[model samples]
Target: MSSFQNLKKSRDARRGKPRPNTSSTSGTSGPGVTNAGDGTYGMDDELASKAREVLSTALGIPLGQDEPGLEFLDDPEVEITNVSSYDSHGRKQNVSPGIDNLRSKDQVTGKGKGKVKQPQVSNEHVRKRGKDEVSHELYKSELEGSGIEVHTLPGKGRGLITKRLIKAGTIILKTPPSISALQNQHFQRVCHGCYLTMKERNIASCKNEKERYEKKMRGELKIKLNRCSGCKVLHYCSRECQLSDWPTHKHECIALQRFRKMYYKTYPTKKQDDDDLSWTQASPEPVRALARIIWKRRVEREKNGGKDGIWWKQIASLESHVSKSTQQEVMRLAQQAQHLQHYLSASIPLKGSDVDVGEDQLLPVNMEDFGFEDVQEVMNFCSSFHVNSFTLSSPSLTPIGVSNSPLMALSNHSCDPNAIVVFPNGAKYMELIAIKDIQSDEEILTSYIDLSCPYDIRQRDLKERYRFQCDCKLCEKSKNQGVDWVDPRWCVRHEGCKGGDGKGKMPVKGSKGVVSVKCDKCQEDFKVNAEEVLSVVQKGVDVLDSDEHRQLDYKTAQKALSTLIPNLQKHLPNHSYPLLSLLRLSSVSHTPPQSPKDLQIASKHIKQAYEACYEVYHQNHATPTLILCEYAKLLSLQDSEQTKMVDLSRNIAMKNTIIRNLLEAIEMLTKAVKQSEITFGKGFVVGKELEGILEGCKEEMERLKRS
Candidate 1:
């Protein structure tokens, strides 16, 4: 692809979302954590606002409008207790003791000290679980090196954070249970409805559902199901599978009916096969199960339900609401039900057969299709152990996610997180990653809510989705954090931060260490103010665009980035950090001109760039590995003509080194996978996928030998 085109593609991906209206974006979000102009942190919309109310009620604190420094003092989720309090030195601090007061021994004399009451904990506990717990477990294999043992972190809730310094595009973790279509079904547990095996058939294994369905269409076979009368959605290959799935599936079946009208009104495209999704109709116990699973018990959903956010409040549901029954309404209801089924099912994993499901071979399977077979017995044969939701892989690091599964759904959220999740088998393989560098003492945290939201939004989503308030650093920083926080107007390049510049905004520079804004024109503080940083950057870009200034742009951008990026280091240590990106970008060098003067300049810049890029990859890196392979080729091109300088510049032969480095990069990635297999548990999907990559690498090595 053309570089500009590639750039555009990169920009679009960062900007895309489920809802595209710019108006919907809140105030304090995106890049540069500055004071939000709106006064309130831009959270309180669809999910978070309601969630906050629940926190307020549970904590016995009324939630007011935005405050410059908002502090959540009490956390209703944590049990309060009276205990002997400690002072700055961990010594017992004496205080008046009452009946409920707690006491402890004094460090100096070992005497008893007065007791203290427990302060309220923040409401930021509920995080969405990963797509698959097993997958997340699987992905853990990949992160073995230690900066912070993510699983051992204190208080931050279970989530994936960094163990060591990690770069951007490092394939933080692949999907776990690297089960392919064929393999996904091979390990299924038998169904309860029937003695039949319940293997996973669909293996699109891609990010999207359609792609997974396509995979299923290739080699799918029919496993008959016993149908439900009210909603013809679920098909049980055996009665046992049907019965076993009933607890969860029924809630989905019933819930699908409520959204029938919404789909007809909202969806641009519709399909007939949508009806097949109604299979979730068999399970309803999951409704209450979901309630329990959504958030920690302390997060009260009742109060939040009656509060703001029209979309969530007006939640279209089947048991609660009555619908008009016109034929169009009926069709609409059917379509909506189908749509809900599809969406809901996507959130939850369902296995079709003990064998891989190929959509091409599937006929309209229902209760009657089984002929003499028992639905319960048959379902056991098709669905069990096949991974109803997961496509397992070795060392599958999974993404923190919200799903319909009751067991997995109980997982909670935390921004200053601990555990990481992944889907090793593309979408199918469930796994997680510890993207952030973790510490020795922190709770394993994961966010059920979307991380894309500003702190407020994230907090509220936790309350609504998982039913808890999030008072983590990301959320706590919102009030004083700044306007850029509310919307986080992202940068455009590939997954780049959409910077505040009207169009130039890239990803926001996270305050990992401290963000130092430098002026492009004057080599001083670039930010006039929080918002003015955009203008400063724009002016710099304009300066770079001019013919005379173009040559200096790289130098200026690099210098400013160095200063600006170090400030970010305190908060995070990941490639996504602006400093790292800038440093890497600074390394790109062009071909030398024929003129001797130009050639020397080119050689100097090019060599510098090469060293920087190489240093960035070091021993192990994912994207850099890909880049190195191509970059080494570029280096080889330069030294193609025999020159004494080649020896002086690079010790070994240029071609030989490039080949070695490329091979090494591939080998490192493979070994990373191998390492994950041990951590996540063997026989995982990520390891399986690595098998393919290893094979391809080996094949390429053979080709290299022949060449």
Candidate 2:
């Protein structure tokens, strides 16, 4: 039975109905009716009517008419997996068919119902459409003398070099993406055109038509998405965005619909033993990404006379690392290409009545008819994606999309990079900003991995994925000068030395694979194995990284994190995982203090976290900004206690410290805000929050004077 039918059975059982035979041959049955031949219960007319009513109400489709060929009488089944509805425009709409049906009568505002007209794309076009070309154009016209030049480095093939000295926090590159794809998992939740999260909770709501009209008059109501009335696959946040994106989305619309149909037809009906259905894990993100590239390439060709259309020549110059990729890697990409080719072949129509009925319908080429050279193009695109794609992530570092940009990809990797890439407002554009001053002709660089990771971990990651041994200055220094006390152990030397006294000691030379580490500073031989501490660290990581940990309530998660803090303190660097995790958990618990004593303890940990992160990341990084933000919050809580203090001398001293801390935090936050603007655009999400922190700081200063 279909999952929907199973759901119907479950609902009937919940309603205290007996299990229906579901296979009775009788033309009709009534409530409490039984088949005399087998003495088995069946849903009789009364129950059948109720069931149909429930299915229609819940599944949004009338019984026997859900799918085109589903026989309602043959079995008690209602396949609602791919249901759709039509809008007033005569275009098929996706789910959430009748918004009025879902909303209460009071919320059925008649405002903003005017039809949105899509605009035409303005560009030069070829007489014959859809021709591919190769060109030697390497960069955009604007980038000709933008203080940065693409240069061939010694070991690194191509990298961005400075044409002139650029100051710290300068906007080095502000380039839009060549092509970006929203993760398939986010198809329904985010607008396909503008990348805005479309969750009902996130969207604005008006109480009634009057309020909506008032908001419109006040110019407060924002433009919202209209579920596309064509293929019913995507939502556009605005008509402008829809019109701008139609060129690319048009090609994939029918193919996406057909793919969905084919996919659901073959989907399993039976429940599996392990039914883990996380969209991120199961989604075809790479496939969708490749599909966008293919369609956009075709569209660009049609519009630009096949002269390396849509500035694709810049991407063509990117290194695919074909010679560097192993056989296993090549095979994996080939398999993915084959899967997509098969899907496209099935999606494209070949005969009468099979043709897609919509704007810009599919052309007359079968993907299955693609030959070796055609498939090779896909393979080469995959190779380029493997080497050059940058993750488009939120401020908190959660990935939302995958994109490749020619300008952004030019910056090479560095462990201690002078520049950083930031995604603003969830858009696919990458902003490359200088975190430190760059001298003339100096190469622009950014870290591909987190810089706070221990040296060994960072190096391994770089080698495996980037296919290069990082000889960046930081890595080189660590290699030549011996490892820093990133991983610590209690010193046994001078029995009362306090185990390096929180200033962890470096391991002695030739200490690799040693059972015991001798502190290079104190010459103390400690009975600690690096491997054992690593094992414990991995254990803590496993717990924190588990799905169960994420689902835990705040109090429960705090308790779980508390147990790991001591182990982390004894072993890991203050700027490493242990303290970073502690700081993250503590930041979440930012309620006003219950007492002065409670506030004091929280302040101590907050200070330690700030100092630790500052030491490792320095002033120009995001971590310091985060830590300083928390510091300002802690000061706010402590500042409130000053009004209650009766001791004159203590009050004066406390006031001075509060002002001092507030000033210092303001300074750090200001730098962070500046860096944030450079990294992301001024409109970034985190920058708004930082601005809020700055406002809070200013308010606290005023409150302090009043007290």
| lDDT scores in order | 0.27, 0.45
609-647 per-residue lDDT for model 1 (tens digits): 334433222222212222332233233333323333455
Query: In model 1, which regions exceed 4 Å deviation?
Result: 1-411, 421-442, 452-469, 477-523, 527-665, 671-681
**Best by lDDT, which number?**
2
User: What is the per-residue lDDT of model 2 for residues 1-707, given as tens digits with 9 covering 90 to 100?
Assistant: 32223322433443342211111100000000111111111223343333322111011122222121111111111111110111111011100000101000000001001112111111121111211122113564646557666654444555566758888767777766666666444454555665655322122244333454577689776554454544454656556556766665555554554443333433445343211223122224545555666666655665666444536666565555455667755655555554455334333443434333321122223443332247566667656654455544334233344555655665666656677655445554556667688877676666554454445655553444445666666666666655334332222122234455433443342454545544545545555555545655666545433311122354554465566666665665555543554544443432234566546655665666667765555466444544555555565455555544544345688778878877876776676667566544464555555565676777767777776
* Per-model C-alpha RMSD: 22.3, 18.0
lDDT of 1 at 150: 27
**Model 2 weakest lDDT span, ten residues long:** 23-32
Task: Point to the candidate with the largest TM-score.
Answer: 2
